[model samples]
Target: MSSTAEEKTVMKVAEEEVINESRRNFLKSMAFLSAVFAFSGILGIVRALGPIQMKIPEWPRIKVANIKDLKEKEPIIFNYPLENTPNILVKLGKRVTNGVGPDEDIVAYSQICQHLGCMVRFMPAGSSSEFPDRNLFYCPCHAGFYDADDGAKILAGPPLYPLPPVKLEYDSSTGDIYAVGMGPPVIFGKGPPGSTEVWRDLVGGKLVGGG
Candidate 1:
């Protein structure tokens, strides 16, 4: 073969290799750019959909009544912490030594049902012929019944759980009955401490007449 032909052949092979290297570098660069853009888009989406923190304030305490207001075998409805939250305060007649009463104690419970978030009402023992002849917390929505002494139990209606109990304290000096805290707020029915605008409205007294 001629040296000129040999050189031309070598030059042609070297040119083809350079072109292939350029194509490979172009493809790699495009791939790197695409990956970077995709990663940035993912981060943006995550930032947009991040979990929101609820800012519930500490539970407030409110005076409901004086010790003299509650009577034996009677239940009174009142709002605690906030007026939107309903509560039931009961005064059990004198405590019974065995089964009779003469020195009973006072108790209070949140009226929100645990099963499906229904309001509970106090049903008098003899007022309703359909119900048993004992005082009980009754849920009219689903016929859920709870013991008056405690809250609702697992034995009633669609509500397989008991009602939430509020912490009640009586002021010795003033004889003022106050609710200090709540057991747990209803999840779906009521908004958490500071999660939504609804809570702010409640705090500002736009919904319940006054905050």
Candidate 2:
């Protein structure tokens, strides 16, 4: 072949190769822009959906006892927001967590056992052979013990969760003690085992008449 003709053919092939390369780059750019747009659209949709709303039920304020009337290490039995649910209000005689009143020794907790649907009895310090040094709640059915001075902590037995403590409020002017709310880990059989959904305690039973 003539040199001039061969040179012309090489130039044509190089021009076509460059044009093909430019087309591939353009397609790649378009694909990337389309993916970005799709991702942004998904994000916008999620934002438009907003967040979930949960309306918690109002806690009832029910008067349980008089702090002055309570004796040291003694328990006052009463039904709280739930008419069927029994609880214990006590003067531990020493300050503790979530305790109320002038001494900060007055506290309360649900009597329901965390292991099973059994009632627990209040045991003053030295009352139990297993845990004599601590004021505790002893479940007669399964022998589950809860620390009374503490936040009803599970000491031993099959109970998977801590006993739900009653949220107490004290009236200094009248020396009155009120049952206001409940703590976490829910109530026995009220929700999932060891759940923190305390709102479930309000359900499955009727609220007491008044504060």
Candidate 3:
């Protein structure tokens, strides 16, 4: 073989080897990038699945008022857990009357609007100015309304569920009002069972009818 031909052959072999090396490096880079992206995707999913920590204050026993203070069809507003936490105590009777004793007429509920955490107020209904014919709860912020008697049922408005009713037990002996437990939070914008919504907006999403 001629020397010049040999040189040309060697050069051709070297060029092919360089091309092969470049291809291998590119493939390695692609593999590394793919692995990094896959790992990042898994981490993102883990973060999404992690538990959300809420900073709700410990439940405290709220002294609503003297049992005798509330009148029929009238409501009282108070705070619990902290001064900032608002609650509503209502006295329901067949007719407007005073004095609280062991009777089915006295009831209390939390005033915090189940939808978006707005404050709720008692709305009076009647032709007479002295006493309201009927009592209802109204949330001015989002027009959420709840029935006063029995459980606070969602009467009308954007709220999908009723206000959360706080469990009340009055000590007949002491005449001190005590809150035993709290009902599940009201959930808005969702139907019955399993669909998720914002916690601050609503509770368990179960709608219980008023008595």
Candidate 4:
């Protein structure tokens, strides 16, 4: 082949190689940019969704009954913190620790049994031959018994914990009985029993603590 033809052919091959390299680099850069934009868009979407917030429950001060009308050892059924939650108010007729009322003998407790959420009934003193001295709160479903006097302690039964005690406040002039708060053994849920989870679950959402 002639020298000029050879030179022309070499120059043409070099130019073509450079053009191919340039095209490859341009494609690689575009692919990288596309990947970065897609990643950025995904991050923006996640940020827009925000973080998860858990809801905690709260209790409210509730009026339960009139002190003058409550009979000793007899319970008045009521709800506390929320509607449809069962509770019992009893007049013990004798002073006991952590008891509240005009005579410091009255007490209140949640009726929900700890064993399996069964309802507990009030049993007056001497009502049960097995437990003769003091009044008792009895759960029939699992034979759970709670002392009516001492914060409804787990007396003799399958209950691993005591009944949740309802804190009380009495109006001397108005004769009205108020449930101020709840004590331990709150009720099982996402949080520990009697923990904030109980209140949160009871209210069915995030609750700002209040009366």
Candidate 5:
């Protein structure tokens, strides 16, 4: 082959290689930009969602009842850290779960059912032959119930956790009953059912009337 023809052939190959290299570089640049944009899009979505605003409350100890004032099997409705969040305080005439005072029969629990936020009412022993036991916290909404004598354990129906019991403080000196804190599995609608974040119970509502 002629030397000139040979040089031309070499130049043509070099040009083709240069074009291939440029193509590869262009594809790499495009891929990098796509990844960067995808990550930015995810960040934008997170920003759009915003942060969850929670009200971290100072758990209050509010005096709710006087032992002498309580009547057996009667319920006194009151609010604790949050207004509108009703709790039932009762004296079952016998010792019970978290019961306070001399008889150990005084107890308190959230009125909200763990199943669906239905208010629970105290059903006295023998009040309903249909119920397996007395000293019951019953939810009429779905027929679900709790055993008041036993930490308000869910006895039947669809409740996921025990009725959230109110932590009680008995003043032997004053015969006063105070609601000190809420138990595990925070109240329904505040957080998720079975959530142990009791503080969430204090988040949504106004503090009990005077507290």
Candidate 6:
């Protein structure tokens, strides 16, 4: 073959390789620019929407019963925070925690059972063979028992935790009994997102109010 023909062939191969390289680079740049534009559009949309406002649930002051209406060892059922949430108020007939009025015997607890989310009731002394000497709160389902005097401590059955106490406020002037807030354990199944809020409260080792 002629030297001129050989030179032409080599030049042609090099030119072809260069053209392919340029085409690949152009495609890569186009892809990178497209990703950058898409990202910018998403950011712009987010900025235009402004900051998101989350609505955190706050505890409400619910009227349960008047101070005169209560009797010793009797429990009054009422809803707190919402209409669906059940709680119980009991007149212990003596000073308990921050109990008010002349005797300071009033106390309250969440009716929702800690064991399996069952409704619990007040069991006065002698009502149950278990803890006959003391008053108690008893869950019929799975027999979750809590000591009524000691902040609803777990006494028996599958409940590993105490029942959440209901914070009460007594207006002596008006005779109004108000359900102020929740205490500890997070009230059974009701919790934020992953339902692990109770775990955090438990780890903190104190009675945390539902905020």
Q: Clashes per prediction?
A: 9, 0, 3, 5, 1, 1
Candidate 3 per-residue lDDT over residues 42-142, each given as its tens digit: 99998999977765333445557677777766777765433445677776664222223477566666677877778888876662243355567788898
| TM-score per model over all chains | 0.58, 0.72, 0.56, 0.67, 0.75, 0.65
lDDT of 3 at 77: 75
Ranking by TM-score: 5, 2, 4, 6, 1, 3
User: How far off is model 6, as Cα RMSD?
Assistant: 7.6
Candidate 5 ranges beyond 4 A from true positions:
1-55, 209-211
Report the candidate with higher TM-score, 2 versus 4.
Answer: 2
Better of 3 and 4 by TM-score: 4
lDDT (0 to 1) per candidate? 0.65, 0.85, 0.64, 0.79, 0.85, 0.77
**How big is the positional error of residue 112 in model 5, measured in Å on the Cα after superposition?**
0.8
Model 5 lDDT tens row, 1-211: 9999999999999999999999999999999999999999999998999987766777788889888889888899997668778889999988877888998889889998888788989999888767756679999999987999889998888998898888999999999999888888877566775678888766556777555
Q: Order the candidates by lDDT, highest first.
A: 5, 2, 4, 6, 1, 3
Tens-digit lDDT string for candidate 4 (1-211): 9999999999999999999999999999999999999999999998999976766444666678887788877789987755656788888889986677768998888888888889999998888887888789999998888888777888888888888888888898998988877776555343565563355446553222332
Give candidate 1's error at residue 191 in angstroms.
7.1
List CA RMSD, all candidates. 8.4, 6.9, 9.3, 8.3, 6.3, 7.6
- Any idea what lDDT model 2 has? 0.85
Better of 1 and 3 by lDDT: 1
- Candidate 1, poorest ten consecutive residues by summed lDDT: 95-104
Q: Of the candidates numbered 4 and 6, which has the greater lDDT value?
A: 4
Query: Can you list the residue pairs that collide in candidate 2?
Result: none
- Tens digit per residue, CA lDDT, model 6, 1-211: 8999999999999999999999999999999999999999999999999989654444567677898898899889887655566788888876766466668878888888887789999999888887987678999988888988778888888887788877888888898888877777677565652243543333322222342
